[model samples]
Target chain A: MERQPVQRISKRALTLWRIYGGIQFSILLLISIGLVVATVLWEWPWWITAVAAALLLIDAVVFIWIVPGLRWKRWRYEVTEQDIDLQYGIFIITRTLVPMVRVQHVDTEQGPLLRKFKLSTISISTAATIHKIPALDEREAERLRQSISSLARVAEDDV
Target chain B: MYEPKRLHPISSVINFVKTLKDAALPLLLVFVLNGNIFSGDVDWIPLLIWIGVLFLVLISGVIRWLRFSYWMEEGELRIEYGFIFRKKRYIPVDRIQSLDFSEGIFHRPLNLVKVSVETAGSTGSQNAEAELTAIRREEAKELETLIFQEKSGYVSTGEEADDADIEAAQSPREKVYGMDMKDIVLMAITSGGAGVVLSGVIAFFSQIMDNLPIGKIYDEILDWIQIGVLVVAFTAFVVLLIAYAISIVLTIFRYANFAVYLEADDLIITRGWLEKKQMTIPINRIQGIRIDENLIRQPMGYASVTLISAGGSVLKNDEHQLRMLPMIKKNEIQKVLKMILSDYQMVDEFKQPPSRSKYRYMIRHSWLGFLAAVPVSIFFFPYGLLSISAGIFLVFLGGMAYRDAGWNAYDTQLTLRSRIIIKQTYLMKKHRVQAASGIQTLFQKRADLSSVKLTLTSGGGAAVAQCHYLEEKDVSHILNWYLSSRREEKPAES
Candidate 1:
């Protein structure tokens, strides 16, 4: 068996994640503001509002300034004739292997954000779960899905 | 065979009981509101209203029974049923996945059976795509046989074809195991259903409490709760004990006459007292067999065997991933495993984690318990020494988890024994394993340790077995176990 070659998601994924992170932080900011208002008007515990604001600040910093870069660096995937391996997560660094024979089907998807960046996400489904290869170039995503399905069929036939 | 047939008249009664069971919660709520909140007196107006409601429900039940008709037409089982609105569904005999025969208390006296029809793609409230509330047992049997005969003709490739071979073997009908009273008690006490049943018991009792003379008694008990601390603790302990006893009794009655038999290429599991459920799972469709032991069961040296079957024998939300043996002695686990699935056997030697892995395991397992103790320790700072003992005990539990956690790969099936609060020993075949991987955490990487995870395709979901804090090389070996199978033998047929 050859050593499985691992590949990373598109570099543009970092920019897309930044935008996604910005949206998330805005929601958190709104919730934090509401908590502050409740604390002032309703005479809620000062500590409650303080804790909420502190947590939101930490979250915003991590999401807007840190996580996207770390997540992009950590996300690596390899699809072989035998299996699909996905390595992800910042703190955990999880490596998951999905055997080709168990692959029921594969699909390439695009949302407004991903489509805008010329990137697509491919989801590989088995009987139980859907494993995703996120943010590949549109053409590359299609090619991967085609090759994976063909390989999966061959594996299925062998079984 | 082309002629349509109606459900037995007894089906109206069964449907009535079903409606009552479904409407039980609302009925109880209404009764409680009328009795307690509305007025103290029980008057004729409410009684008349209740009677009228029952009459309407009974009429609907009768209408449903009158409308429902099924028959074999064009070699397909065509069923048409509706009270106000009618729809028809025809299922090809070859596509019928499994035919289940059940007899609740209502159907038992009449010698009638409830038939549930499952297909390859059944996604509904109840897993069964279609059901016949009441039919003759012999008629259900004939229908099942007829479908099987037709199904075998076209579906004779994998599992169904193997059943054809087992037809010759069916005559003997070997009795594999039967649960005795001792085993029943052991299983009942060890059953994890206590949590689910306990809540149900509380709900039932609370509803009863609202209307009964026991209301004043519960009020006095609540008065005692105002005393707080020791009273609360004592009450909680008593309630827990009562719940445990009730759950055990419930389990014993539920699995009263548990028995297993191998007929052809299918294993037949029969259990329950009030509601007898008979399920037949094709042996070939079984994706994996698991020997599971939770916290309570493990301490008593008992483990249960559950089968994971794909694309067949679905009943009630669960029972599809049915328990083959509820509780057997830990030592007897391997014996039972071999008896049921012969291609694999248990191993005496397991791949143990490194000695230092114990410390990591202790920290990982005990952190939550430790965090919980922090509050108690803070609140009772003047007598905070009381909380230190709990912390120490939790630490000891973590050590025990480390002692328990290990892995063993025997031929193709990997048996992993891992402990958190609950000690679970999971077994899965290499081929059945859908995925496997190894991860190295920042701490683990620095310590030259890695964790392994194995994912198996379970009934409608994925079950994962993971071992944390192992030698990097060992973790890698665990990852490759699925891909490197050399002795992956098919389970021996009975």
Candidate 2:
């Protein structure tokens, strides 16, 4: 296989992803509590509460504990003068190459959550597709965006 | 040309007819909803209201045609239109890409054409910037010449310059390809149009059932079936045959007199019998070429070629315009393609995937069907066990897909062929590809297999061409082939 892109996304992305997972787990916990209350009030079957509890446990383990770490390890990207190379995905590893000439624009976006963590997502757009490197340090994202835009200006082609 | 010109008076009639066609389905439903007029059970109040609405629509069409005016002013195509809103749209001549002309039955009789103004700014929009419902053919040609001169910034110095303009307008177009009646018939017969028509018929019946008294119909059908189930089945068979015949006739009408012509830098396609259409696609706008061979067409040695183009909203509205060669003998594609796009080459020899990948292809295609079959068999018991045949059929299809999956890189061109029911082969240039990717699943990584995918811009969106489950080396080879383009161009430019 070809060598994977060298640069990795910010390590803080793992914590951000885990926090997102925590929010989802909290929602599931609320639903499980509701199921337990229903089992008591309506005298419903006990298995329903048991199933909800098992689902909440699995959700906590998979989303909050496992997926974020593996995803952080898998994500890598490298931007050169000639092209942008991205290696991402957990189970199905995908590596993409977008030539500099085809880069239409680059944008750095930050949501309220990401802003609080001092992180931003940089998206590189071509005429055909958009590739996003999520959760980069705010300053690093700005630097990369400027460099990519300059490189893209140097290389020109028709759509 | 500076003066605002009104279209031929026939435009009002054409506009009325066009509006009527758009509202035909709703009008039909309205008529059917009322009691049968033939049985003298018609509701007069709704009928009167419908007549009043029709009159209003007719008046609006006339007003719209009367208000619409177009002129060339200050290097822009200026159009002022609308009855109530009074909108004025000025499209710069430089932004105008091409002008498409089509003729409906009404326009044909009046010797008029409907001109659509295509602009690059209208890329993702569904409609063109402007349209002239009906204009004299000669007038349309003159307008095209005027716009061309304005775009090229040509100043007419004298009568000699005007003479040259006339000469250029009369330049001969080389006929690249044309479909004869026999091939059109063959294409119509082999097309999957019957299935579409069958589904449409089913949908129409279901819609009618929702509005009408279905219980009464059910009682009548059940009574008929009680007499003889064979009779009911025979009637259904006849309905299917009729639907198939209707679809065949529709296809023949749509594709009749299809011909391709090569203008200076444009591929001009003119097709249709009753409602004629003419589309002009710039040569440079074409990103790649795709050849499709459906199961039936492949066995019959026939295929269709579709041009993957990057611009033109005219193509976005009617995708049929993208089908440069709607139907042709498989062997004739090369001869015809050479006349049009000589840079692209059709490679016969391709590096196929290893034999070991066959089982992977089979599993990829049939796994979902097998999973579904297990649940179905458990639920329906003996009857649902028959669903296993579907999984077996899918496995057979997967074997076909594997047999056909192959890729070849020649010079700057890359051809990737794969199948998912209809076999598609994409011929893309190195520079035309916007992005490329190589994907490997966890299981495939252990097996040292990867899939190569490339994207080409087509009509404001990306068209992806992929070949699944190939050797790791072959996948890298394709990726390297794409990556090498930058290095090769850098030295050449320096």
Top TM-score prediction, candidate number: 2
DockQ by candidate, in order: 0.45, 0.56
What is the i-RMS of every prediction? 5.6, 3.5
* Number of the top-ranking candidate, with DockQ as the measure: 2
Error of 1 at B408 (Å): 2.0
Clashing pairs in 2: none
lDDT string, candidate 2, B1-494, tens digits: 67899988888887888899999999988998887889999999999999999999899988988899998888888999999899998888887778999998888888999998876532223433788889999888877887888778884433233756767765589999999999999999988999989888888867766887767778797675677588757867887898999999998999999999999888999999999999988787788999999989999899999999876568878878899999998899999999999988988998999998999999999999999999999999998999999999999999999999999998889999999889999999888888999999999899999999999988778899999999989999999888885665531211
Query: Against the hidden reference, what TM-scores do the models get?
Result: 0.84, 0.92
The TM-score that candidate 1 achieves is 0.84
- Displacement of residue B279 (Cα, Å) in model 1 is 1.5
Deviation of model 2 at A69, angstroms: 1.2
Q: Count residue pairs with overlapping backbones in model 2.
A: 0
Across A2-117, the per-residue lDDT of candidate 2 in tens digits comes to 68889998989989999999999999999889889989999999999889989999999999899999999999999989889999999999989999888888999999989989
